[model samples]
Target: MADFDEPLCGCLQDMFSCLIVFCVPCGGICIQAYSVDKATSSGMVCPFLWSCCLGCIGSAVNRGQIRQKYHIEGSFIMDCLISCFCGCCAATQEYREVMNRERPK
Candidate 1:
């Protein structure tokens, strides 16, 4: 009975751990998805509006560093989503710049 209880406890712990790892990322992605939809509907791809995404990504980076130093299961995954979205936006800006630079009069 004791051995069975230990395994059960371990499994429960693992489930909680996984949830903590994913929850922040899920939230961040939802926000970014909304941002995209809003941008498309408005017909304005405002790079300045993406500053919020940068903030979220910065938070994630900070959390990741905290986790590294303290070994805490902080919400660092949010950082990943933010970073990905920000990177995509930045790349798009660079592409636009290059295209404009090559445009003929």
Candidate 2:
């Protein structure tokens, strides 16, 4: 059960993240999809295509992949539920995870 390094609400602490979460047509979600693409070794265009094609399911799959990579505790069902219900929040959390991990600590 790998724990998230940052709080889910950590995005709220960052101006850009806040914008991403609040932005109606989220560019943040795209950024997160790109991030996941890199992390999963998926094609650069895959996430974008998924976002355009599958919408919430794309981001949910991305989140599931990320969780798998990090050994985080979650299931696909949960990912779908979260992504379906709170996509912005889920994207914000995923974006924070990607950004925080990439930064030099």
Candidate 3:
């Protein structure tokens, strides 16, 4: 299985994502969720509410989804821990992974 496109600590490499995640984590998570699934983005209010109330759980789920989609090697427990302890970094790394992988060459 492949690993994450970028390391968790590599969050700093993408300054824009890092700044957004650091300053407005929920918004960053919303964007990441949207990028993964447009249908989810339509219900902006619901996601925003969830992000506010269950940010860690939401992020961990989202991280797992990303890992599944990209075939990245990781477990849900690790995702949970990363999302819980390094929320901003995890969000930033997720954002970068999606953007980097999905972007056209």
lDDT of each: 0.36, 0.73, 0.72
* Cα-based lDDT at residue 46, candidate 3: 53
TM-score of 2: 0.81
Q: After superposition, how far is residue 104 of candidate 2 from its true place, in Å?
A: 2.6
**Candidate 3, superposed: residue stretches over 4 Å from native:** 38-50
Tens-place lDDT digits, model 1, residues 1-105: 011112212323434333432465543333333333332333223323443445555434432432343343435564456355553332232223223333488
The residue-by-residue lDDT of candidate 2 on 1-105, one tens digit each, is 987676665667667767855875757567667668656778657776776678778777888888887778988788888878877667778777877676777
Better of 1 and 3 by TM-score: 3
lDDT of 3 by residue, 1-105 (tens): 989868888877988877776786365766666645632334445544545677777777777777877888989888889878987777778777878887789
TM-score of each: 0.23, 0.81, 0.79
| Top candidate (lDDT) | 2
Clashing residue pairs, backbone N/CA/C < 3 A, model 1:
60-79
Q: Is candidate 1 or candidate 2 better by TM-score?
A: 2
Ranking by TM-score: 2, 3, 1
Model 3 superposed RMSD (Cα): 2.8
